[model samples]
Target: MTEIRLITFDLDNTLWDVGEVLHHAEQQMRQWLDANVPEYTRTLDRDALTKIRTAVVTERPQLGHNVSALRQEVLFRGIVSCGYPATEARRYARSAFATFFQARQEVVFFEHALEALGELAASYQLGALTNGNADIQRVGLDRFFSFAFSSADVAASKPAPDIFHAALNHAGVAPQQCIHVGDNLIDDVHGAGSVGMHTIWVKLSDQPNTIGHTQPSEVVEDLAELPGAVSRIHTA
Candidate 1:
């Protein structure tokens, strides 16, 4: 068995509960809409905004461009379609959506998240690979990771091997020497495994049980369990 010298983490649901944070963001966006775009209050509800955003993103997959930029575009479209003046729509959209994006930065890390990161960082070269705009530097997790790569920066999202390969290259390690941990089954586990990197599925309650679905090197319920899992591979 190969010793694991590098441990890469997925940002959103791995280190923190992304669903909770996104719920808060959605709440904030709805409040902003209600306060600013009062005319379409009944029509442009939270569910409506979410549906429209999903459709727009699906239709314009190429515009997986920038999460923030895409988010802004979606909010602007929502507001304009609600009958707001174009100038007012742009203004409120920028102000309201910027607040929502900034709120994502306030996402709370799981208990022991930093401790687990620090522990892992001590022995192995640590890096991060995320699909979203999780600015590790801005989030103050930069110290824990030697290198951080995002789909936004790589121009390729997860389930694509390029993003994973980019992280491996950044860490100066081979695929076999590193392990990727993420919450998503397809993007984090299957994708990394496809590229010859060991993978750990960070199981979350919201996600269905993927135990028999895809083979990861391991499955951990929380980030705190990661260090031991990685150590076992190194020792074996």
Candidate 2:
């Protein structure tokens, strides 16, 4: 295999606990809504809000909308469904949803992310490619990545070759010279492998060995193990 010179990462589940982040964000949204929209305080709870948001997203999948837009829409629609006027619904939606989405910047990184990123950035070109709008700048990980590409920016999500190719192009590296690390088997391992890039599966939880069914690659439980995994692949 060609010597690996570039390393691209998937942001959400790889370097951060997305579950924890989303959980906190949800709680924050609920508290904000309850305080501001007294009528909603009695009617809409977090679970109901979540279900309505899911329905909206499923119904409008082709809108290519971001989470922020969807959240606002869900809040407004939920208020209107509860017999609130359009003007009042829009007002509460803007205030409550902005508070929640902006607070997402407080999400914490994985324990090993800083040390691993520092070590690898010293030796190889580091980049990020994510299917979601995980603002690296807001997350304070922007300095570690040489380039960052998001599905929102590229109009193509993971499991698609276009997102990976965009990351390689931004990093000025060829497929054979880069290894893509992510938590999803199909999106990270299979997609990167399809383009001749090495793969690293960051097993955040006890995930099954799905990669075994596809092309063989390295696996690590945490970001700290990533440097060694890359070294082994290079020396193999």
Lowest lDDT sum, 10 consecutive residues, model 1, at 204-213
* Clashes found in each candidate (C-alpha, N, C closer than 3 A): 0, 0
How do the predictions measure up, each by TM-score? 0.86, 0.86
lDDT of each: 0.82, 0.81
Best candidate (score: TM-score): 2
- Clashing pairs for model 2 are none
After superposition on all C-alphas, the RMSD of every candidate to the true structure, in Å, is 2.6, 2.5
Local error of candidate 1 at residue 222 (angstroms): 3.8
> What tens-digit string does per-residue lDDT give for candidate 2 at 1-236?
45888999888888887887777887787788777776776887779878888888789873343556776888898988788899989998898877777777676778888999999889998888887667778888778887788776676667779888897888778888898898888888888888889998888788886555557468888788988999988777
